[model samples]
Target: MHKSRTNFVFGEGDKNASLLLIGEAPGAQEDLEGRPFVGRSGKLLDKILKAIDRDRFNDTYICNILKCRPPENRNPSLSEIDECKPYLNHQIKLINPKLIVTLGLVAASTLLGKDSSLKDMRNNIFYYMNYPVLVTYHPAFLLRSPSFKRNAWEDFKRIRDYIKD
Candidate 1:
């Protein structure tokens, strides 16, 4: 996969952050820059964090389930996810965040192993390897469906509350 890509976005942010955000996979801009959440979605994410009084740079460890981007920004295959999960798990272990937030259905499904709709998943707390997981709408989704912004904000407030605890 590395042969087909420009860079490996292993993720970035505070190593000791108490909050960790996991997305589905890297997008084109993220792949081009070898950085997580650096595109328009990322900018929206920044604003979302600010609304909750959190910062990705100083407070949260932001990463994706698959470090490498899929060809054409397609959804990841099961094999790809299987191959990449260990790396993500290793990162989670190292960060040991108090809460793990999954942005969008793919992420929530991948980690929580639930096929429930995003609406059903939102605001509900699940567990992955003993870490608490909260499901929410992705920033990109919020960009497309502006109505969901309120829901995402609510989820972030829940995230803030968890970190506070």
Candidate 2:
């Protein structure tokens, strides 16, 4: 685990968090803060989670495919995710969460093992290693396109519904 990246931390809250959020990589704020989801996107994510009656800081196990932040927030290269996959896999095994939510294209692509548009990816739940995965637009995208908030909200509701079921 230590071999992965320096800016990595286990999710907050209970060690047995039921939800896991897998992201692409740490942003500048995440790298500097040594925490996942601390920047603008993180803030927006918090709101989404709150809307669904979940608290990211206390309910979801948040992580990235790559622990290290890519230069200038660039997308993580395939090799990087490959190198860091074991750590993520280990975390997933240890946490064994019931629901896994993937944020952004890179994380979703890595999890799904395919490249697809975010528009086509959302609106449905997929299975990976038997765990339910819900893919949604990254909060950064919502920041760029506020109109997508409705779609994001719909996804969040789906997550909430999954939890209920």
Candidate 3:
């Protein structure tokens, strides 16, 4: 699906990290920079990680379910996701993370192979390829709905504690 794309936002951060964060897809800034989480949402994510003493460059790997940005930042279609699933699977295999955090519903659904609300998915643990998976709101969502930042912070704290263990 991304073969004809000009820029491909591949995975970043510590390749050897035991923690991995997966977002839905890249945005305009990420598409331009060929990196994931480089926009406003990216900035927020950085702060959230810093609060828990986990830096993307040092402690975790970050990527998205889709390599190419969907037009106008719309959600990725099912066919697009299907095409990109293998790449994400390969990334998970290579990173071999002990825990995986899925940001937002699209990512959680894609990774978990089911559709469910964020409320139903959060504050709990699931598994993907035997790796523990945690669901959380995307930074973009938190940006739009600042009211949920508290919940997101709680989730991040859990992630921090899990990593420490």
Candidate 4:
């Protein structure tokens, strides 16, 4: 199913790494660029990653739940997520990361098997497929709600702590 959608980005890191970042489907910019986190939200995400001392182009492997961009930047439907999930599962298995960081509600809800606000999701570590998973607010959400950034900073600090130790 994902084969026909050429816009999706997929892969593990180039070498041994223990952390994986999974996001929701691509946006228009990401679809066009063939990379995850390449637009405005991506810019903010880069800042956040830098704050935590992690870089997507180097230490972290990034991918989406769905490879293709949904029409009009809308949320991907249940069937889309269901169809593309196996690929994500496979990537996780291959990477064998010690930790998985799920960005935003849709990605976290799908991976963690629960529907909740980012507020409810952050600051705690969960488990998925036996790997430690951390949940955090999406950069887009922080763009909309700048007041929440301090909270996100705390969450990123937690991730750094885990990665460092």
RMSD for each model, in Å, please? 0.8, 2.4, 1.2, 2.0
Return the top candidate by TM-score.
Answer: 1
Give the TM-score comparing model 3 with the true structure, all chains together: 0.96
lDDT of 3 by residue, 9-123 (tens): 9989999888999999988889889999999999999999999988889869999999998886788999999999999999999999989999999999998987779999998
lDDT of 1: 0.90
Clashes of 4: 1
Clashes of each: 0, 0, 0, 1
Model 4: residue 42 alpha-carbon error in angstroms: 1.1
| lDDT, residue 157, model 4 | 89
lDDT values of the candidates? 0.90, 0.81, 0.92, 0.82
lDDT of 2 by residue, 1-165 (tens): 234445664344445778888888887788777888899998998888888887865657788887777776677777877988898888888888889999888888889886789899888788887899999988888899999999889888888888777
TM-score per candidate:
0.97, 0.91, 0.96, 0.91
Model 1 C-alpha lDDT per residue in residues 1-165, reported as the tens digit of each score: 667788999998999999999998889999999999999999999898888887888878899999998988899998999999999999999999899999988899999888899999886889999999999999999999999887788888888888888
Off by over 4 Å in 4: 1-6, 11-15
Ranking by TM-score: 1, 3, 4, 2
Best prediction by lDDT: 3
Give the range where candidate 1 is weakest over 10 consecutive residues by summed lDDT. 50-59
Native-structure RMSD, model 3:
1.2
Judged by whole-model lDDT over C-alpha atoms, candidate 2 comes out at 0.81
